[model samples]
Target: MKSKLTTTGSRLNPSQRPAICLGMPLYNQTRFLPQALDSLLAQTYGDFNLFVSDDSTEAGPGQIVNSYAAKDQRIVYHRNEYRRGLIDNWRNCFELAGEMDYFAWVGDHDAWHPRWLESMVQILNTCESVVLVYSQNVNIDNNGGILDKKIKPGISTLGMDNTRRPLVVCRQGQGFGNMVYGLVRARALRQAGVFPRVMWPDVILCIKLALIGDIHQVEEKLWFRRRTDRFSMPRQKRALFASYRPWYFKLPWPLVNAWMLTRSPPALAGSETGPQRNLRFNLAAVYFQRWWSKFGGGSWIGSPHEWRRGKATWIRKLKKFRTAVELKSK
Candidate 1:
């Protein structure tokens, strides 16, 4: 069910709009809410508005935000009358942003380095062509202790024309999702649609952003992503669509992504020349062929090796069963 959005604070005037806007969509994350807010508030760059959209059921999160809002006028708080799934709350942050030159989506549990905003803002201010700027990320446990897992390398589609950008983003295996949290050009992000209701929406957003302009990566690790089961696939599926959904809404990702990719060319294809359009189609075809070879059709059943292995395993089991039966008869 849909709920009315109630604001705890007043909106900003257009003339008073900040240069950067940090849209934070929070749920039931009271445990680390303070840390998350502190990390952003401590940023060296202070000319930004922190808009928080809360979808948590408990009053704990609201209370925390209220306490913080009392101290910081820059922090704007809005709460839903009832819980409205993940994507809506996320989109709400952007909707409340009014107008801004740059925007970033900060997670409720993720913490950032003191200079994160300062560093990212510098790039956006100086680079005319760059639309998004992100940094390397470090994984942290619930206790905020750094995990020893291998950090995925950063990827950049900078300098690649719009035709080649989608191909690179598709081939990118890990760490690309982090780019969604990076500072983005507000206009370009709007054009891409903040968060589309699709499987792997971050991946699609990155591809769309790539088509818009350049994406750059800061070499340093500035973002701390909390590793938690709250991000499990089942939980994500529920959050991606809505709070309530029928079983029929659940569909396999590959088929959905394939269909999404098929439709993407026309929707995102702006005024492109004939050759550019053909090149994009060819690149997408190449990616699909490679994807099939790696994961889609090539790795699954019907392979000769798998068939032989299954036959050998069944034969051994049958022989063992017969020997046991004969021993019992004797």
Candidate 2:
């Protein structure tokens, strides 16, 4: 499935090659698309290429992206023949990025302060051991009003052991999945594994990167995240799994956990020391707790048929949990 590029920006000279690639994977987000692009164009740090991969069904989104591409030679635009869903579109956008020192995924509905790129790039430049850099986020309502500020508190994993960093993410990280939008070293991102096509795959990628290097957080709120009520949590999960792994919803939660655990980066897999072992166990426990909260606890108390369903669910969960434990042990 090759994406046909619709428009290419002016080729950068060797000396003018971008320091970062801002990969924007967008769908039918015409309402907020212009704002997002404007924010990128306003970046204080301009040595970055903007690659907009449009998976929108309508022409509005493409038109907007093309309009931006026309004005800014740094903007490269590609519109897909059909909607490739979120994960595929994201992967395609990253792949479209030419060789660059850093890469950052930008959401269509999100906005950034003018200094966002500058602050992140500074960290990546000075800190060779850090693979990812992100700032605190501001949560905005759909209408573009600021709803909350300083949403994610800063936590610096700098100078931590590689194995210890991932555990910290698993336990204390406030914005685990949101780091997908952070500025990251291009080579480290490729090695950690380009966004996996799985539900909440960003979390897995974050863990993988933690196993390789430290993650630095900027205390300032430079990133803005728009919150929408269009898709509930479960609905989003169903759509994500359907698009990536159709069988994911049918399998027991433990099986899904086991599959994702096995997909951890090679760095994490190769280490079998005490800290690594503890990390695996703690992660598994967290997964089980989430699974039980969703499927096993309060939802079980109901009619006879519901009770029977609950019993079956528990049995399946236990069986799959044991299987995952055995696999991790080996």
Alpha-carbon lDDT, every model? 0.74, 0.73
For residues 135-196, could you state the per-residue lDDT of candidate 2 as single tens digits? Answer: 77888898878885455555567656665666677556666656778999988888777887
How far is each candidate from the true structure, as Cα RMSD in Å? Answer: 9.5, 12.2
Instruction: Pull out the clashing pairs in model 2.
Output: none
Best by lDDT: 1
lDDT of 1 by residue, 1-330 (tens): 111222233444557444789998888889889999999899988889999998887889989988999999999999987777877787889999988899999998899999898888777766667788887899999988999888767676655667766677666635657888999999888877778666567866776677678777887889999987634444566676456653434664444544455443444556667765665556456445534332211222323343455433455577699999999999
lDDT of 2 at 259: 58
Give the worst 10-residue stretch by lDDT in candidate 2.
1-10
> Model 1 — which ten-residue stretch has the worst lDDT?
1-10
Off by over 4 Å in 1: 1-18, 244-251, 262-272, 275-330
lDDT for model 1: 0.74
